[model samples]
Target: MNARKVLLAEFLGTLLLLAIVVGSGIMGERLANGNAAIALLANAAATAGGLYVLIVLFGPISGAHFNPAVTLAMKLRGEALPASLAAMVCVQVAGAVLGVLLAHAMFDIALWQPGDHVRTGVAQWLSEGVATFGLLLTIVLGIRFRERAVPALVASYIFAAYWFTASTSFANPAVTLARSLTQTFAGIRPIDAPAFIAAQLVGAALAVLAARALLPAHSSVRR
Candidate 1:
């Protein structure tokens, strides 16, 4: 595929993904009558469904990697060029910010508010690391063993991660950053995003190493 087309796919995919995440959080919170559990359930369900569709729609064009961590993993695995990695990450972040703004506009909320949701602590950071590690492991293994099931596998894992992880699994750096701009159910405080991001990167790196060990480059599994 052409580079520009690939970049467009990443941008649009990330945009829609964030829109689904933030918009659902806003709607869920408003409708849940202060029941945080119900709001979180709705948010997780919407995000999982949207993510599956987005991956299926964009996979052929751009590999459907909306996360910077995933892009970095691809680069490490030699599946993406360095320039492509940088471009994809840039577009992903830009698209994520625009998505947050789009969600705010749909709900008639202030467009550029900084998030104040306090999601800091060692436990939350550890949760982020584990969540990201599992996510990357799922992607790598699914692609190698069941390429057609990647979308479903990822969506299901994220849905589960939302409930299991303390930080609700903000495993994507772009998502963590963009979400910090919205003070909603899905948002994380800007002050807390850096640690989450750092943990996520570490988790992704570990996953890559684990995947390589589980299935070396010479493995017979289809790439």
Candidate 2:
């Protein structure tokens, strides 16, 4: 694909993913009001459905590395070309910012309250780690194995991660940054979000390194 096309793909893919996360969470919250279970289910459905659509939609154009962490990981293992890394990362992040800015226009949200910090601390951190790992693992296995399971793996991994991880697994960096802008049900406190994003980047990088080590050298080289 052309450079401009790839950049557009990343931009659009990220917006789509962010929209699902923010839009569904907001709608679910308003609908459920006091029902936590309903909210969680709605969030999970949005995550899974969002991923399924994104993977297919952008796979051809940019391989849909909607997260900066994922883009870095792919670049590490050479699965992604290095030439477009900077462009992709910048566009992806910008897309995320745009997505959340738009979300702000759509939602009724408030500025931070003191108690909000407490909710975002432990739960968000742990959830971020698990979500990052799941995302990395899905990419590693699906791409490495040449499995026809890429779509299914991504969807299922994200869905299961929501319940297993406390933070509901906000794995995408673009999503994280975009969310920080909302101050809504899906928002992440800006201060705390960076640390979680760092953890995610570390996890993704490690997974890429481990995946690289697993390949047979000769086979890897023959490509």
The candidate maximizing lDDT is 1
Q: Rate the local accuracy (lDDT) of all candidates.
A: 0.94, 0.75
Per-residue lDDT over 18-122 for candidate 1, one digit per residue giving the tens place of the 0 to 100 score: 999999999999999999999999999999999999999999999999999999998888775433778999999999999999999999999999999999999
**After aligning candidate 1 to the native by TM-score, how far in Å is the CA of 78 from where it should be?**
1.9
Q: Which segments of candidate 1 are over 4 A away from where they belong?
A: 81-83
User: Which residue runs of candidate 2 sit more than 4 Å off their true CA positions?
Assistant: 107-123, 218-223
After best superposition, candidate 2 residue 34: deviation in angstroms?
1.2
Report the lDDT tens digits of candidate 2 across residue range 58-149: 88778878888888887777674633778888998998777665554567544222113223665667668767876887787776575557
TM-score of each: 0.97, 0.87
Clash totals for all candidate models:
0, 0
Q: What is the lDDT of residue 106 in candidate 2?
A: 67
- Worst lDDT run of 10 residues, candidate 1, spans 77-86
Score candidate 2 by lDDT: 0.75
